[model samples]
Target: MGLLDGRTAIITGAASGNGAAIARLLAAEGASVALLDIDGGGAANQAAAISDDTGAPVFGARCDVTHAADVEAAVFQTLETFGRIDVLVNNAGILLDTPLPGLDMTAWERTLAVNLTGPLRFIDTVAPAMIAQGEGGAIINITSIGGSLGFASYAAYCASKAGLMGVTRAAALALAPHRIRVNAVAPGIIHTEMTRGLYADPAALAEITAKIPLGYVGEAVEVAKTVLYLACDLSSYVTGTELTVDAGYVAQ
Candidate 1:
């Protein structure tokens, strides 16, 4: 049997890239999935594609996770369709690469809203249902290595992710009594559509990859597998941890 057999999960920002990878992997491992994103049509398309590939029930809904009403409505819809939510992956985020001295306040605020507040909104909306079920659950936040270390052009993103790490720890404590586990995954230099532009410049990509012990960038699937481990029973004893899937980049 698959690790997530007979389970149901909700994955935010699942229209493409790492979010899409997680959705596909979870569904493959026997979980019915709900793909939530602000991009309605794109999410629908991804849902359809995954359902076709895995022969598992997959649903899609338009949800701006930073908005309370949108997150609440999406949670309700997920419950109505799938009965219960076994896992929640907060994978939605935006990057505002600006130096602190000349950074735009507007961009900083927006980054925090999507990267940090979005996860809080989801946890608040879903945790109650998870508690009521009494079956326990998992919450996986997609943070970045930027949170752990400072990068030159990623001030706002780093700050938001660092805040998310704090949220992960706090949520883990709050939900432990309910048997709900909360954790975060910090990925570094992953090859996703979001970072394709950087890779387009061969020298830049090489320079970045050189810092990693693995000597290469990671794939979305690699990150997805780590997420799956956190979501499954294999990690029953694990909680309030940050799993760094950074190819040893941070070790240097």
Candidate 2:
């Protein structure tokens, strides 16, 4: 029996990287999953692959987290297919590295829209449904170390993630009575397409990896495992907390 057997999950930005890893893990653990991504085709293909690999009921849909209509449609579609939403992984986010000296407001706004407001849209659309389900649920937000440790050129990204931390805590308090748990997972220097650029430059990769106490880059599966823990009964008592999966980067 898998930890998430009979449960259902909705993972945003699940076409690739960490989001895809999380979806695959949860589905393998027996949860019906909806992989929602801006790249609809990619999401569908990944979902089909996971279904084949895990024999889990999984589907994919196009969802733009920044838009309310898109968020509503995706939630409706997931409920229509899976019957209930037991877990929500708000993994849809974008990072724009821009310094404050001459930062473009456009970049800042876009970053917040996708990274911060996007999660809000999902919570607003899904929380009420979870409450109505009466069985309680879990909401996990994907954050970054940039939220805590300021990055030189990541003002917008950092600010957005920090705001998400606030959202996770506030949402937890608001939904505690409903048995719904809200939490945030902060990943550090994970190997993903999002960080592929850094990998291309050996010097940059080494410099970045050197800062991590683990002495290496993290993988998507590791982050997925953390999300799985929070999604299942193993973390039943955990809520409104930020679990840092940064290879001890914050400790330094």
Candidate 3:
């Protein structure tokens, strides 16, 4: 049997990249996955692909994590379809590389809304149901190494992720009694659609790869595997922790 047999998961921003990889991996491990993305069509397509590949129950919907109503509706839809939610992966985020002087307040606000508040909404909407089920659950937040490390021109992004790390810890403490474990997976320089710009420039890619003690860029599946570990019973005793999947980038 798979590690996540009989479990159900909701993964945000799952249309592509790390989110998609997470969804696919969870489904392979026997979890019913609900893919939520701003791009509903893309999410649906991905869900269909994973379901076809793994023969697992997977579906997709349009969900804007910044909006409470959207998040609530999507959670409801997942519950109705999968019957119960055992895992929640808050993986939706945007990167805004802006320095201090030209920093856009609007961009900063949007980043917090999507990166920080978004996870709050999902946790708020799902926590109660998870409690009612009485089996305990796992909530995995997709934070970033940027959350703990300084990055030039990434003021808002760094701040938002750091805030999410705080949220993960607080929620973990608050929900431990109910047996719900909250944790975060902070990724380093992973080459995804979100970081396509850096990969597009050979110099930038080389510069980033050089910083990693692993001596290479990380992949979406590598991060997804970490999410899998947290989502499964393997990390049952783990909570309120931030697991960094940065190829030892921040160790230096």
* Tens-place lDDT digits, model 2, residues 1-252: 999999999999999999999999999999999999999999999999998999999999999998899999999999899899999999998988788699889999999999999998899899989999999999999999989999999899999999999999999999999999999999998999999999899999989988889899999999999999999999999999999999999999
Candidate 3 global CA lDDT score: 0.96
TM-scores of the candidates are: 0.98, 0.99, 0.99
Is 1 or 2 the stronger prediction by TM-score?
2
Pairs of colliding residues, candidate 2: none
lDDT per residue as tens, model 1, 1-252: 899999999999999899999999999999999999999888999999999999989998899988899999999999999999999999998887678688888889999999999999899999999999999999999999999999888899999999999999999999999999999999988888889888789999888877889898999999999999999999999999999999998988
Candidate 3 residue runs with Cα over 4 Å from true position: none
**Stretches > 4 Å off in candidate 2:** none
What clash count goes with each model? 0, 0, 0
Q: List the residue pairs that clash in candidate 1.
A: none
Model 1 has an lDDT value of 0.94
